[model samples]
Target chain A: ELKVEQNPLFLSMQEGKNYTIYCNYSTTSDRLYWYRQDPGKSLESLFVLLSNGAVKQEGRLMASLDTKARLSTLHITAAVHDLSATYFCAVNTGGSNYKLTFGKGTLLTVNP
Target chain B: DAGITQSPRHKVTETGTPVTLRCHQTENHRYMYWYRQDPGHGLRLIHYSYGVKDTDKGEVSDGYSVSRSKTEDFLLTLESATSSQTSVYFCAISESSGAPHEQYFGPGTRLTVT
Candidate 1:
């Protein structure tokens, strides 16, 4: 069974601060994904890290993947109020590689 | 928004009652998935369909069943609703069962079994 774990399940950070959410997986996987969900809303795709050392950034958020270490990270640079939401990291593993096992998600609260 | 919609956005039912949730997509994607989100558990796949009449069980598919009779519609049925089944169900669609094709999600349906 492939398992994904994320750190700082609940985070409250002041605006303009920097923070990183970590995602660690148990098995080998070539693909990783980051998603964000607002309260009572659906998930919004943030980034897809396809290879080791692959990094993608959007606005103040950056995501990187290290497949060899079975780890991924979502870094928030200068967090803002708009960045307050729950972020999730998912991994694709096993034979089919179509199903994704997701982390418990890091609920970030950016306070001004 | 990926043109995906889940019916009965919120539903409450008693235990042992049969409940069915509908997921409809206009994107005509080749892959459709059903996932349930609970506090501290994130999202767990319940079932998925690759094509019409082709479906497969997911990690938490014990008391759930799925049917896909058309390209744009997928149905998830709970044989017997249980209190443990209460959670927010999300419907997702993807262009294909391959990497880089991110899954587009629906608004989700909240089901509460009493």
Candidate 2:
């Protein structure tokens, strides 16, 4: 079984502060995805890290993957109130089909 | 937003009653998936379809069933509703099950069983 663990499930940070949400998975797989969900809304894809050393950034959020370590990280730089949401990391077991195992998600609260 | 929609956005039912959730997509994607989101369980895949009449179970597929008669529609049915089955259900679509392709989610259907 593939297990995904995320730390600081509940995070409170101030605007302009920097924080990182970590996602660690068990087993060997190469695909990792970051998704954001607002309260009572559907999830939106944030980043997809396909290989080791893969990194992608958008706005104030950056995500990186280290396949060898079975770890991925979502770095938030200069957070804003709009960044308050639940972030999830999902991993795909190596296969031709799409079967994702997701973390419990980190609920981030950005205060002004 | 993707052209995916889930019917019965909010539903309240009693235990032992049969419940069915409908997912419709206009994107013509080749893959469709059903997932349930709980407070501590981020998202658990219940079932997925690769094509018409081609469905497979996921990690938490017990007591749940799915049918995909066409490419644009996927239906998830609960044989008998239970309190443990109450959760927010989401339908997702992807162009392909291959790597590097992201799945787009529907707005989700909130189901409650008493």
Question: Which runs in model 1 stand beyond 4 Å of their true positions?
Answer: A94-97, B97-99
Which residue pairs in model 1 clash with each other?
A: none
- Please give, as one word, the docking class of candidate 1: high
Per-residue lDDT of model 2, residues A27-112, tens digit only: 88868999999999999999999889999999999999999999999999999999999999999872666778899999999999
The per-residue C-alpha lDDT of model 2 at residue B90 equals 97
Q: Candidate 1 — what's its lDDT?
A: 0.92
DockQ of each: 0.82, 0.89
Interface Cα RMSD for all candidates? Answer: 1.0, 0.6
Model 2 error, position B68 (Å):
0.4
Candidate 1 residues A1-112, lDDT tens each?
7789999899999999999999999998778999999999999999999999999999999999998899999999999999999999998753453778899999999999
Best by DockQ: 2
